[model samples]
Target: MGLLNSLINSFSKTPTSLSERVTTLEIKTVCLGKELPDLEHLILIKDRFPRREKIKISIENETLEEIIQIADIPNFQQYQNFKNKFFDDELEVMITIDKKVEDNKFSIYCFDNFMSDFLKKETSDIMKAFNQLLKLNNYLIFEIFDSSLVPSLLLSTETMVFKKADEENTILESDRLKKIETCKQNSNFYSNSNLELIPEDFHIKTDSNSNLRNVFEKIETLLSIAYLSNSAFLEKSSFKIQISGHRMSNYECDINVQKLKNKEFYEIYKWTYTDGNPADKLIIARNAISLHCKNLDLINIDETVFASIKSNFALYQKENVMQYIDLKNKLAEYIVKLTTTSNDMIYGLFDKFKNNLIAFLTFLLSVYLIKIMSNQSVGSVFTKDVTYLSFLILVASFLFMIIGIAEVYFQKNKIVNGYNELKKNYEDILDKKDIENTFKSDDLLKKSI
Candidate 1:
């Protein structure tokens, strides 16, 4: 009688223990657009639940199979629900699958507390078994959530690539951190589970679907702007003349060509750097386009120049030509002004140093003269009667040296303040206003179209 009671008690406790484990489990899956074996074709080989009780089955299938036991489950209906919800035409879904085990059986349930080492291990094992059973060639991403609904572990068979943070500037560093945080927040699996997952949001699909043409256009625009900004401060000797035009048949004289055979217009001939200064290939390509637009009338020209490059010269339409030129000239003038301001500040610094140097030299000379006058053999004029006068001269030289040092310090502070203001303005012009105006103009054009 005692042994029978003990066995019944153990059996009752098994279901409760299993139920606790199941309620804490959370599963997230990311399929890498790979074909999976039919679920109906899978054959259950074994069932081991909260108690680890394993049962063997004899069945034949195209692939090896196994069954995970969950407590308090009566049928396969719950599992089917999970599979149906995860299926997608685009082969991507971010969801949390929940199951509960109780009373020595398992059934699918709503998500509750998910934080558990045991649950994480179980989820991982299930994913691995599924991969093997389906003979999947691509890796699946898995994440386990804790009781607080926060992910405790993210496991994937594929390597993840992350953009490196810029360490040189505080603003860039902050931007990088924000980007990372945004990526995490908008992540397929981690985002608000209610939001429907889109294939474009997935990293793998995004890489494949990105528009290369648009990307190249943006690169070209940025390169052109960079070239213009750098050339603004270049010396005349370092500026190479880039002439592109056609010789008019009627006049037998070269006239500036505005349009190419392909209906593209000439924007601006880039001021190339002399001495073969390594240039951005994108900028070089822009310059080639400009030349092509200029020399459209020429019978024989290098066709290879247009080989792989897409012409964005059409973007520089006649309507926008004057505006573009005006913007460029304004930027150049701003840079030149900044250069002049910096030069003036440097000269002021040098002048202050020279003045201080003179004052210091005068002090040293006065001290040497006083020493000579005080020497009994060298100067009897500095006898007891005039000894006080010598002391006064020494004190005055010391005062002058102190005053000179103070003046230099004050002048340096003023120069530094001016330079700082100039630097702020320069950065505002180059970094903020220039890019802002470019994009604004582009946006305006787009809207007008």
Candidate 2:
């Protein structure tokens, strides 16, 4: 009787608490033909539904449910249309597969809004977590699918950024040609050629400058950028769009189909954005430029380029300012170190300047004394003017000694205080890993609340 009641509840159209629980319960056997060993470690449940061979999973939220239903289409065209109506709410995809031997059953997920934004900010973090999972699982595959929701603005025919941030030496026509050449070469040689150039391979020249074209070349070579169809740095407009995918293994490059054969683990794919709808090639070039800016020495920043970066990208501003502060603080410490000496060395050098000053004074005094004695012996050989000059010299020497003493004292005291302050601050700053761990723990707590 209990079994019959449970079966009835599972199939019910009307929502009951038990029915809701059943919806959330992962039907593992349907997805992973064999029950995954050590199920506790699984990030997503592998569920089996013998009756419903056509797989379905539901979330507690209705808005999300609608988004999933919209995205559930199997073809790229349908998914592209669904992407056009993107809203602010988060979207997650749940996959189901039919029973098959080996690993035939799998599902893929894409973020809606909130998660997309979160993962965008924490791209490196997402990669780290996914790689960890890949190491743990022994038999899964992961890949990032490259699908263009919209064309990029920077790479688009309507848009052109002509001015270099530094100065006005025009991006010459020849330079533009060279960039195109590089792109053509990249298409022929590399597997992940920038998507913009993918059309070029078919003899469709979406014409642009060489620098912009070269950006496409680099994007073609880089795994992450090639898949996104736009640069990660989207300035000039705030319109938000992103790309994402999941991996079945660590070795699998998300955008490349050729690398999937050897992968044997699962990886949650990343969400990336290129705002302003810049051309995919332009986005790639911008990223390379941004990376170059980061490696610049702290003491020398190109003011014009920096101004442009500050005006355009918020992330660049935060990162550069933090780096600048660290650089300034380190220089301040070096200045303090150069002025101070070890305690043992200090004892040997202490009063050394004063002693030198004293010796010079003694030698002058002796010369004056000799002149005075000679004048007494010879009567008019030394006059009153000579005596006055001797007195002036003595006074000047005393002043010199006083100034030297004050300089040494001030420098020594200043260095000692600076060192002590730095020591205290150094003690307060915990290990980098510990600091990051604390931040993660705090975030988890806040999310729970």
Candidate 3:
């Protein structure tokens, strides 16, 4: 009874929550520097719908009629009009298919709703159908949005290339692509690519094996591609990839990589103004740029490129002034520690000097008392055995004073040595030499440009 009630609830849509529910989902594939197979060829494949029992397939109305006419080849315009009307938007499932071809790119979008369990279950079947369509392409990305609303679930594939080196079943086996694979393995940010009902909330799951990790991994892989791709930074680069978008509407979230002509560098920016936290987005941008900097260093890129990266770092620091203040506080604390140690050392030597003076005064008092008790003059007290004892006391006091003075001298020397070391460290931290050198190099580069 409980299971039946849950199933009923899942299928039923509340009028109050209608605006919050996902109205559409889209999947896009981009083949970098390569053209993809035609939409007509994919749709016309007779055996593509082998698993028809799992999910029903539908095209737009006119395209459906054209499919019925076995002798006719559906033109691009016919394919555009053919909407997947199998699912009802108000009641049941509404599925749609659209294909786009622009220059060297090809794209496809599959749109559906959230109110049906059947639609959720059949997502894998839909992807399977699309996969068969896109199998001939070399580079592909499968991206989907859970809702049209803000803070929605975004699942996407990492930019992947189909390699001829491996068997046809293995699409990502190229040795040259190891860097991207490494980034994917290390990233813990994305949802799993497996087909499943989208979670109601965008909060990260606490479990280690959740789908969110897969989503993060895919994002990292994309970042790696942006950071490592050389052609992305070049001018008039002939090699470009094919990309697809929804025919019905633009993607809710997208990443665009462009080469900056003036700076001669690549910029990878995300186009999701509605869905993400601004701070998180800033962090993602900074991290991607940092990774790009490391890559630039490894390749021994031109000094001007590094200078631009340095300028970016300075800009970032300027934007977040609070972080710079915190850094200043840390340096101040280190200086205080050094000053405290120097004070302690100097004070210890002064304490030793005070003790030596006290001891010498006590010796003089003892000599005076002995002279008074024996009914002798101060001069007479210095004769015979008394004289010997007085001389011994004097020698001992002199020796004690000399040792204290030596110890003070040694401590003074230590303080001097410590101060010199501290000074050197301060000088290094505040050094303007490196800054001057960098400025000179940048000026030379600017003149050349």
Candidate 3, residue 148: how far the Cα is off, in Å? 66
TM-score, per-candidate, Cα-based: 0.26, 0.19, 0.25
Q: What overall lDDT goes with each candidate model?
A: 0.32, 0.32, 0.34
Provide the lowest-lDDT 10-residue window in model 2. 262-271
Model 2 has a clash total of: 28
* Model 1 poorest ten-residue lDDT run: 164-173
* Best-to-worst lDDT order: 3, 2, 1
At residue 241, candidate 1 shows an lDDT of: 21
* Candidate 1 global lDDT: 0.32
Model 3 misplaced stretches (Cα beyond 4 Å) = 1-351, 384-391, 409-430, 433-449
* Highest-scoring model, TM-score: 1
Q: State the weakest 10-residue window (summed lDDT) of model 3.
A: 242-251
RMSD of every prediction? 23.1, 24.3, 22.0
Segments in model 1 whose C-alpha atoms lie over 4 Å from true places: 1-381, 430-449
lDDT of 1 by residue, 1-449 (tens): 12211221221222112221333322222231222223232222112122323212111112223222333342357445434543442222211223332222222221233223323442223223332322212222222222222222221111211111111111111122232233233221211112221111122211221222232222222222223222211121121223222211211111112111210111221222212212232344445545554645322234454442324333433434666566567655645664565466557657766776676567556655777776734445445745676566557766766776676567556645653454354342244545565445334323321
- lDDT digits (tens) for residues 1-449 of candidate 2: 12222222232322232211101222211111121112222212222223323445332223444432311233445334444444333333333333221221111111122123323432223323323322222222211111221222212211122221122222212122333444343322122212222211111135332433433322222322232222222121111222221211111133222221100000000111223222323333344334433555211223453344334545644664675566457745654454344342355445655676677667656766886776655454336875676667668766866876676677666655654454445333333443344334334223321
